[model samples]
Target: MTKLKTDRREVPVDEPLDAEVVSFRAAFDQRSPIDQIVREGARRMLQSAIDAEVDDFIARHAHRTDEQGRRLVVRNGHLPEREILTGAGRIPVTQGRVRDNDPDHSRRVTFAPTLRDAGRYRT
Candidate 1:
């Protein structure tokens, strides 16, 4: 699959819960079509949310930079794709990555610490 460029400005506000009957093409996977749609949508949602969070981090640190004048925190594209097991199913996702120009910072510069292996915890 190709890398998708999502516009961070396109985050939706509040939408009505859509439970209407929808059609989905059957595939080898046990997940129903709706499940697949949900999985993909969830993946995109998660990616977008993280992207926004990263943007906030970058903004907060924008005033700080290395000696070369490069931003302290910058968007580093994304990490490799990984599967996140959810109640819906195992959905493949590629999370956004950030480059920490300042190595002295205490934070690890990742969603990992905030997300903290979501699959292992039962929330």
Candidate 2:
């Protein structure tokens, strides 16, 4: 007796389900696997860069508290009233108590910058 060879057309290859493979292909085509990977990587890189910048800023301006447990960062001066201009309009500024100052009378009082100041101290 001779061994018989199976027809190539009757043999099944190692392939995924047609529906599953079609869905996968569609998803990849919609977003492109390469593009999705690149976008995720870029997003992570940008987030890391932003985190590093924030960390550096915080390290440079670490806050300290006084015996009274007040924020060491200057917030206001001894001035009674001051004029401040904002996007809306000009507004009156009320000064906060002086926390620390030079022994010498330099007449320059540093005020704590607020969100309004955009991170710039007022003098």
Candidate 3:
């Protein structure tokens, strides 16, 4: 019998490495821990900014009822919900309902999340 030598240059047979590579890339690049934290912070900051702007706008335009049973200047027919910072903390709020035929349109109905329960609500 003659002795034969086998080549050792062939690749090993196993699952393709491409899938593992792809999964690693996705896990590291797409949803990294740092990325998630930064995203959450940015979202909170944006929400705060929006809430402040809405409150300021409402304060500037809103009017109070008068002694003569007439408002000096009605801004909005519908009382808008405002994101308010109270002694307790920031809160998501909805204003009381107003007459349907009221003339003022400045009072906008705003929807904002409270600091305590901000992240729970999603669009």
Model 2 agreement with the true structure over 51-87: per-residue lDDT tens digits: 4544444344445445676544443334454444433
TM-score of 2: 0.32
Give the Cα error of residue 77 in candidate 2, in Å.
28
lDDT of 3: 0.49
Clashes of each: 0, 2, 1
Runs with alpha carbons beyond 4 Å of true place in candidate 1: 1-29, 103-113, 120-123
**Ranking by TM-score, best first?**
1, 3, 2
Sorted on lDDT, best first, the list reads: 1, 3, 2
Candidate 1 CA-lDDT value: 0.66
Error of 3 at 16 (Å): 10
lDDT of 3 by residue, 37-90 (tens): 665665566556655654554454456444565643333433454444533233
What lDDT score belongs to each candidate, Candidate 1 first?
Answer: 0.66, 0.47, 0.49
